[model samples]
Target chain A: MTTTRIHSTRTPAFVEFQASPGHRRPVAAPSNVDVAVIGHSGQVGSALLARLDRTTEAPELPGLQLREGINRSRHLLVGDGSVNQQDRNPGTLSGLGARLLAGGRPAVIVDCTADATLPRHYPEWLRAGIGVVTPNKHGFSGDPELYRSIMQAARKGRAPLNYSATVGAGLPVIDTLKRLRRAGVKPAAITAAVSGTLSHVFTRLSAGQPLSEAVADARHRGFTEPDPLEDLSGRDVARKLVIMLREAGLSQVRVELEPVVPDAWAAALPGQVDTIEALREKDAGWREKIVEAQRDERVWTYLARFDGRTARVGPVEVSRDSAFAGLAGSGNRISIESAEGEAIDIHGPGAGVDVTATAVLADLVDAAFLLTRKG
Target chain B: MTTTRIHSTRTPAFVEFQASPGHRRPVAAPSNVDVAVIGHSGQVGSALLARLDRTTEAPELPGLQLREGINRSRHLLVGDGSVNQQDRNPGTLSGLGARLLAGGRPAVIVDCTADATLPRHYPEWLRAGIGVVTPNKHGFSGDPELYRSIMQAARKGRAPLNYSATVGAGLPVIDTLKRLRRAGVKPAAITAAVSGTLSHVFTRLSAGQPLSEAVADARHRGFTEPDPLEDLSGRDVARKLVIMLREAGLSQVRVELEPVVPDAWAAALPGQVDTIEALREKDAGWREKIVEAQRDERVWTYLARFDGRTARVGPVEVSRDSAFAGLAGSGNRISIESAEGEAIDIHGPGAGVDVTATAVLADLVDAAFLLTRKG
Candidate 1:
């Protein structure tokens, strides 16, 4: 008999057989579905474009046939989510978001842009029967009213807006919380090191490098936001925590504390990486901060914690045995204390164009299923 | 004007929110659908029964109003799965499995049993257009031919079979691999501490507990199989690894080696745990084995590994930094080294009637989606 198994060398008994059990028929691309993507040129956006533009690709689940490139009769836009003069849509996704809210046929919109103004339009899109999936965190975490509005829209639309990538990139944080809630498990607490940008910076800092050096490395490696200040300011991590809290049915969550760094240093920061040097130069106490940090073996991690009654996002010192201690560059780890009081940890690479894009694609599949279920 | 946010009590700036963004219309349960559950009397089965019977609860997902109890015509038999005198149509899951193939109305068959013979009928059930959601590992990790048969039936019937609970209870190991593969990240290797029983045994063993004492503790906690021999045998872990490998597109797996424990000791063991003392007494070298293990800090973990070309399941000494080393009792951890050279770790409770049952219910929601998609 022929030996078809790759690891057949390990076990001689594993011989090739013509037909094995448990086969699944792969789902093909959906036909004539009008889908539009709002962000195209950004990192995650470009990755999604590449995935969709690939000609010879494996079939995807939830069965989507992505017609990449911009054509707003249903388009996959990949820019800053702002509509151009060549299109019928405009603004922070409000154009298509409204289009979805004012729906006719079953269409879809996958958001890859990270603009705060765009998420305001999500409820309308969902309400109009448009399936929405995104990695953009601002949509869910920006304002509590906006968060409720989005959910209310979804409830009215009878659609699902998937934001699994919003919390831990490719990690299934939000989905886990949702499933746990649906299964009657109350999520008691959440301790997550979710910002890959901060994790990368801290990983380098933990390795005896100075804060500036770590920041420089993270910026160079494309892990930090173009503004670097946004990551260091802790706003990114705070937004992510807000989104997660809302999903756990602990809503109306607001960032309880400002960034741990001094306000003067953060306020002096410019809007982009062009001013990183100035931002660092203005921070006189960074070295002193390091000395205080090095006085102990505890590693510094920008953490988001919600203990049912309180939700806060700030820097915290985690010990060697802490799940957050071993977090490497751009990796996220979440230790969830479920209602059963079971503490579980899920870890993985939390950011990257490919990883984030993979999360977006998966959400597309989820949105498709949600659509089917709605029907 | 009202500060309704929970964390508002902690931070003064936090206030109540009127709305939020990114809404998802929660799906209600399906109406008037036929769902037949086999192995209804077992732990997971009973849990499923309780869930179905609790209809006055939250408008459950996809609007499925489960009519729980034993009705033989299309029964949710929560028992040993043996077609008793009460069965209307016996064998191959009664008329339920066959009805799915016949293709009339919407139907579902949730298998909660753990019998090798019972799973052999999954293919026929799936082929009959019946949705199958199961936590039973046997159906997937059993005979290679049977595995292929079930999959072929699913493929031919164009129905999705969900088995996420088969590997890591409520953890998303199978779903993670599926998404990764679909995104073109070939999963390269798997290193997992997959057995809760073994995890318990090892956790105790590492704490200087005698092998016999550890086995007794595990049995008392209900972590071990009723016949602790089945757990100690490593066969369970082997089967789980097979299912994982196949999900990563590596099929034709086989368990070529038996448990490391002496055949004389294991073979002489009784079916139930009434003779656990005899097992400890028969083991003439277990204490010495513990001393050897304690000489160094290396912890013994029942690890299952597949390194692209080789697959092995047995006891191995893991260093402190090893992912498996951190696993505690009833916990499961899987480290996947994907083709992208990323080692991702997923850890959580591996087993429990409640946890496994929760996973089954989630899959039921998924199966409902799959059914809608198929239509």
Candidate 2:
């Protein structure tokens, strides 16, 4: 037992644990949950698999069966480590529901893929009563029609489709929004720093590091995507803003994305080496902007805002005393300003494999609980 | 329709609210929830009753049947406004479970009382398979034995026991702690400004107001207890700290509170007028401390901290740039620093009747959903 010790403020007192189950995870007869991983080899997916497969004295989630792993080319049986003959079926979410239902238990598809095409299958899978849990942003933040369809399908089938990891990694961003919407408290405006990579880059720039070094550092520390252009182009932040806006009742708001790097600059630096060299060459321009911001006692921040309908995301100069200026490292900060003039701020690390995977597992557990009770 | 209009950032677009249900509340056949409000005439309870009874065009919580209202003197049937013959039963939580069970639907008890003895009924009520939702702090932050029994009974009966409003009103404090614990992330330290009344008082003090004036102002604004001594004595903050520390897995940690006002001064004031006058007479002492804080460029904040096991709460001098110093009005701010040194901060109002009622309703809805599904 790894117990945290502290200096006693009073006499040594031991409070007995009543041999009770911890909160949330009820100590009921074990309900088997058959789970399929769509992006099985990805960072979050693999971490989730490892957590599910590892057995411990005190099990957090018991009876979770890793039925199959479905990647692009193959479908592998998790128990036997053998490649299944049935590959990705073009229809019916690659037969994910069928495979999981074969286990005679609650079925769930864990999508960790960041690709756009996977989300198209979410509605069909959810409508089939197979729960969907993911850190995937493409489904909720992409096409409005798809987002609407996914929500409708989940409701129609009475299945749990949780995408809390889509916004601020493991932070309770989406859950907060859903609660507010449920109570009919619509947000008048939402100001957010949703991209951890961009947050890091801006924090470094504020600390006098050049843009090229900041981008390099972020990528080296695994904060940015494999292609850093995805983060640098501000699409990631835009996507998160879209998700929040949709969650806040503006389902089809236009997000005018103002990228940190210009389209011409992004187009100019296609290759990795060329991108680094080009960014290094453009250091002088960034230096001027940084100096200007410092002179005004302001910090440069990539901000995303949605006020009722107009949604825009880009870099902006904010006061030194502002909350946005206080953010550091790979942290994400979202401030929801409700129509009633109440504001709630949530801050945490917005990107990481462990945290994101844990979020997916939390959602999976909720779905499994619902499945068990409904069954 | 009270629609908020915004200038079109693009072409005017109407994203149809598809013929689908909202995110959380399923559009299936209505699940009737028979609710009995226990302190139904109290501030939070009355607000909750109003919200539950109001028939808006767009019903936020549908199929909710307000069965009975249990106040100090009477048990009134909410539907027809008739008093029931059965008063306080002195046993079985005043027969709350029996009355709601008679409805032949999902039964729930919403405890909005602050008395200490109401918590003793929690274990028995939960063990009987009736769900509980409360904003009451007494049941959670009081005796360790009762806390253990309540949790054990909840798990044993598979009942949903939610107290999210206990610590931070409606700021998602307990929910965040539960999520982190579920993911196996143990918080190393929890630093919080959990008292909205004290937060307002200190904010005023920092802005050059005397302690006496600040307390009076807070009371005038309906932020403090009817008896200001409860807020001034610091016991409320201590109870909140205890609840938070237990939620962070230190279920039996002792909280040593340093009151904002000394015992000598507190005992000297017997009435409301005497309290205000005594506080005014002690203005010189508070002014000295305020001036000293200003000289050091610090802000006076009532902060609660739980470092592993040693829980302590009181007033502290924090730098102006710190998060605690930034809390304004009646907001609560809680920062959970994980063992790995990652910190997540949640900030919002810590005291309000409407928000607290909403928090209780959210929990009630969740409990009702679970019951509906289980049935």
Candidate 3:
């Protein structure tokens, strides 16, 4: 194991650990806070590390010390700016969280990986009084049992666990839902265009582009996953829908995914080239559907809809003048209606490294505030 | 003088004073918390009181006790469900803040009044360690010096002062702006239609209704103020813009209001009949503009724009295919663009007694959370 030491030149300013404007003050200004970044070498993780690197100068987050940065092959320490090769990989990062808290200071772990196995460690870290902040959806959306345990652990140890970036990137979807629930206003329905990758592809298709070409365009624009099949399968949007339903106070959530791409084609795909060829094979079907929508003054969009009981995601036709039709490239829109028929609509970019990094940093600050108050 | 005692059938459950989903826990479950309502006789105030009345059974806010209910003519206590007329009035309610904290319990004041005079007492109450939550924009949008003092007092006494309802009712405009600032992202520009009354009237005009009929219809639908001039003058939206600008970290804000109704007509309006007649006289001018917009395939809307330095509110033309033109009757919309050009658009109803009351209740919960942590 490689050990790391982070020395923040500026004094730790816990006096500024506030949620609102100058309102919250901890009992004492804490001296040190250790932040361990798991998977900090990825795109968003590296952006977050860069932001944290500037915290000594940035007033938004005053004194967050980046204790360690762990990736696939190495765990780099910040002090002395040292880098070392790790004998073990991140799959065995079970005890790293426990070691972070050995100094008897407040510790927070930022999980920036999309690894499925990493979420299993969240409950342990949270129950041990270590804060957990993540933009990863696997933890909450993969297994419903895991979601319950994570929430339970946060309550048991009184540690803040924030994953606002899991669903809508930088959008306030989760926080808004929590606020509505806190005020005794339950949502009756949720209609959303959540996946920026699919949104971009379908928008191009609506503009008379070929399906294969649109997929390649989105891939070149960095909107799709390395494997374009991941974006075409509709599973990504389905996971987001599950997370949203649970946040909307639904105890038992079952989302039915009707993928725009046929499930069989996505399942048996071999490689990226084949994925493009497969998309080309389905061009005629999609073109016919698009022409039908055009004839009826409608546009096709991939949408996730939840009406109190049922949650479904698939390609749906909306009026040409509707908000969904007006969504441009890489945009996300959600219309949430309350039990009383009141509605609020939010629209913004759903995918970006900078905005997503900002969301993670915001969560880190909130976690730090929680730890400060604990002291 | 009359003294009121409030009893909660449920135990004071301070453990549930959480901002997230069961993530925050106070050190101790406080025994009692007193909530004093000032100006509880008005429309929103009465709705908030009714919601507080249901708190005994609602799990959202568990055990907040209503200690005092003060209107212009009387202050009634809740003990034994008694109501009595008082000799003294509310204008002299200077020392009530100190008295609420006399019992050694946590105290919070919910200001539901639009009264300009009551805000003068906010700093005293906040500095006394009593939380202040209000839907009243008068406190923050009035004298700039008072805004500074209220914020300073909140810091000095470490008490929460929340005014989220001041800007977009329950639409999360202020909170979103604060979040953007906290993430080190300052908005470059803001374009908003924040007044529901004005939005309704303009939408009606765009649909070819006469200006006088539109104003009268809005007033009859309870969308306008008691005096139509207040909404017609564009002052209401200007106040909201000021609050938004201040929250956006602008130190000095000056708003130039170009009313849809002519300044002279709104300024010297004698009564509602004259107000309607004055609107009638301006019908041809508005009709000409509307016809020109129709010819150009555009729609007119009252908009508030802030471009970092200058703040202006006036009538503007938007393309018929744009979101501003798509905004229906009584809907509010705000688009905030960050310095980096990232944008988030929020649309919803900006006015309603129930939603505004809900916003106040949400703030009350937040204040309760803050006070609970202090104990």
Candidate 4:
């Protein structure tokens, strides 16, 4: 019954209602939708809007209230604008505000904010029968009990809760895993390179580039976080691994990430090390190390191994012929090995504004389909 | 609905039910099982019996019969005893024939028979609500329409139709494909080395052994079919490929296997040429050919490719570093490329009496669970 509320700077943002007696409301007839994009500045939020706009065959619904820092909209409008600019709109939702029941109408909340600290309001959303589509992995991976609670709420609410974008970007990993579970095949182990940023960095390092150059290359290619060092540090990959593990039913497992943060960055000023040249100066020795590994027939790989009961995260030296060694670019690959069957290896693009957005869009489509079925 | 009935034996073995004029006898509740074992004399059949015996945890309903060939049996029991073995107690429905449904009890017809001709009875068994479990790939793969008919009957009658052993032995290829489909994934392509016998033969050939020696070694290791030519001819792999394709929703495709039977066996008497010696004779000349291919850093692989609309079967030379080239032993491997996501690879054991029987048992357990759920 714990309800978490996230605030926007534009208008009063309401806390999701728990499934309690006073919160019960009559089901409303299906009608056009009015949606609010929470964390519109984030990747997933933008994607959801694009997907809704492209659906020409669908019945025209009331459009979204473009809110950035606050919620103040009295009416919905059809248009696109930057989140920062929309923050100045007079009708944006800002702090704790009035609860509006999405009812039986096509009202949706697309949470695309990457802020890990934001309180996940899955229960509240589910109780109100409002569909939720998110690219955020945190909700499911954070606490096992809460994850199950969210699923239970969705079932009770008869609403869709989709998080496909939380796993393999557009690779369909979550859907695939769900299918396997439904078919009674238990996953025995999961080995993955779930971060495009990490994979690209590894690919560059394996090619004998220093860690700094790899980070710069990833940034130039738009494959890494704005601060490239954040990816090299392994937090991004760790979060993805946690999400995958939770989906596989290992809810309580904690992934211990061995931070291989470049040593040079430790001695530099935080702001100074944010740039590519500063990062390069810190880990220049990685070039020789990578060359040595190549001479010995080993390739550098960022790996996440999830054996049913536990999970581990680290960088390993793999043979060139191994599956992990062959993964290239900003691709993400996941291999699920089962006790009774052959391993299933799924590979594809893992990170990008477009790819991540596409994944979120896919989740939205799934939710929309579920809602249609419910009706 | 147009229904195709495929029968293995030329003589149709059927039991007719007399319909009361203008009256339907209250459909008798199934109280006993009159089963038919199509390939009772084969290894797969023997292993299936072993699996049935282990299912003692759940007592099997009585009135069970096992029939092979054209003979009718009131009670068909296969064991190492006298052919006329009978139980001292005459149970209800004891005199029933091979018609699985007339036994007045839940019936299970296990077709461990590998005879391609026997697939005709699949629809008949399905219509009668008699669950059919088979290691034979022929029924589902023979005609695409038959696959649809079988699935429809299974759903309509709420009967189980499983043939996991048909493609990957104990590996869960069929099950995985079913799960993938249920999750809304449209498979675009399937690439696999599905024949264990062929994989072993090729592996030995790659190791510089004579063709005859490789065949002999395969037979000695129980890797090849009794008739080594069956494996060499590529029919086994073709059947497996067809089954996989059918499972992925291509119910109309039929594979016309190209005969790759070794030319040396064309004129030789069946028992005259020992495999090892035959391979030795063929090896002397083929050695240079294999050596030349290896010199170019190529490895030979027998591959089956299915691209939704069309399927091709052939052996091709691939780079040693390719995924298929690294496959070892008699492993069965399948790669699925789908429109909804990237490619997925599944690989493991393809054939063995124990493994094949295990697959059948797994299907049985699945059916039991489903039946329990329905109840």
Provide fnat values for all models in the order shown. Answer: 0.19, 0.16, 0.16, 0.04
Clashes of 4: 43
- Evaluated on chain B only, what are the TM-scores of all the candidate structures, in order? 0.82, 0.87, 0.88, 0.73
Per-residue lDDT of model 1, residues A1-375, tens digit only: 101112212112222212132323443443333457766656777788677533123433444544333332334433334543444444434465554434344567877888778677687777876777888888777666677677667755666678888877878778777766555455777888888777777666667666766787888887877767767777777777777776765654444655645456566555554545665663445455445655765566677877766677766666645667657777888877866777667788887877789788767765664464333
As a whole number from 0 to 100, the lDDT of residue B194 in candidate 3 is 91
* Chain A accuracy as TM-score for every candidate: 0.80, 0.87, 0.88, 0.76
What candidate 2 gets wrong by more than 4 Å, as runs, is A1-29, A53-63, A73-76, A80-93, A204-214, A264-273, A278-297, B1-27, B53-62, B80-93, B204-213, B262-273, B277-299
Of candidates 4 and 3, the better by DockQ: 3
Model 4, position A53, has a per-residue lDDT of 53
Looking at model 4 chain A, which ten-residue stretch has the lowest summed lDDT?
A: A16-25
- Model 2, B105-129: lDDT tens digits are 7778889899789889888878877
Candidate 3 lDDT, tens digit per residue, A140-227? Answer: 7776567667877875576778899987788878877766655656678888889988888888999999999999999988888988
Candidate 1 lDDT: 0.65
Ranking by lDDT: 3, 2, 1, 4
Q: lDDT tens string, model 3, B201-283?
A: 88899999999999999999988887787787777787888888777765465776777776665666665456787778889
- What is candidate 3's TM-score against the reference? 0.85
TM-score of 4: 0.63
Error of 4 at B357 (Å): 6.7
Worst 10 residues of 3 chain B by lDDT: B1-10
lDDT of 3 at A125: 93
RMSD of 2: 5.6
Sum up the clashes in candidate 2. 0
lDDT comparison, 1 vs 2, better candidate:
2
